[model samples]
Target: MDLDHTGVSADELRRLLRELSGDLLSRRRFVRTYVEMWPTRLSRLVAAIDDDDLDETKVVLLSIRSSSVMLGVTGLAHLATQGLHALERHDLIECRHVRDLLAESGDRACERLLELEATESMLGR
Candidate 1:
């Protein structure tokens, strides 16, 4: 449950499970879906920034930030927020840096989530 290095909060994940009626199946499914979509989301985000599509970048960033917060992916949420701020300031350079960080963080988060899911399954949680 010490998932600090993963940038995910176990307590927050539990809170989300509770909010989802405490359904273990639902929790697993949600985690799976989030992990599965991360690559595409990251791609779109990078593409938007590369294209200099400010509106698309904002949309993608907000989407990432909101969903990350909901799923307790605190690191990703924080990075997305920073990306938003950079966008707001018209700092494309900073936004690019954040995008790189996001890629790394997103990969780590997905790996951790998958490990957590496997652990939960093995323990029948």
Candidate 2:
């Protein structure tokens, strides 16, 4: 999917928000909750990677990918998918490459999410 300069799929976000009845309050609540929990999820991911446990990594990535897709964090979802594919192929090197890319993409996605939250607050969304 084409993403905005923020490296996030704003269109997807807009679509989902519309589906949520355009409820800014709900959106804010959900976003806040996800943001609060993301660090723990990320820590689990790092631990999985450190252990070089492919199964654990795959499980974590799957969870992350699904959550990201639901929340329109396409860059992160895509990176996670790439990692999964690498793992499926048993390409540890490629998996590591995608892991770095996932880290960068996830950082960008989180920054964009914060920016979105700030924009919403500023606009009284």
Candidate 3:
């Protein structure tokens, strides 16, 4: 939230988050769900890049960045922000931070998923 550069409304953002939380825990709960969604969304972002869909790619990246911030993955958020900036500027991008973060997140998520997947695989033996 680049308040210094971009004039984003603090009140409006608070209101938006407030409005979204319902039927259970709170807005904070939804942030967790958002965090879980990030890894999967990266796949679509990469696909859009491969397809040369710059506009959609940019939009997706920006949304992913925002999700990263809202979800409190600071490293992930930095990566996403770097990617978004590169796409926005239409310049050659070598976001090592973003690459590394994505790799770390994917590796971590895959490890967890595989562990769970194997739990069933080894069950009842």
Query: lDDT per model, in order?
Result: 0.83, 0.73, 0.52
Best by TM-score: 1
Q: After superposition, how far is residue 22 of candidate 2 from its true place, in Å?
A: 2.1
Residues 17-47 of candidate 2 have per-residue lDDT tens digits of 7777877777777667666766776777777
Candidate numbers, best TM-score first, in rank order = 1, 2, 3
lDDT of 1: 0.83
Report the C-alpha lDDT of model 3 over 16-62, residue by residue, as the tens digit.
34565522234435444654675667777777776767777777778
Better of 1 and 3 by lDDT: 1
Collision count of model 1: 0
Which TM-score value belongs to model 1? 0.88
Best-to-worst order by lDDT is 1, 2, 3
Rate residue 108 of model 1 by lDDT: 91
Task: State residue 56's C-alpha deviation in candidate 2, in Å.
Answer: 1.4
Q: Where does candidate 1 clash, by residue pair?
A: none
Among all candidates shown, the one with the greatest lDDT: 1
Task: Single out the weakest 10-residue window by summed lDDT for candidate 2.
Answer: 2-11
Looking at candidate 3, what is the lDDT of residue 117? 28
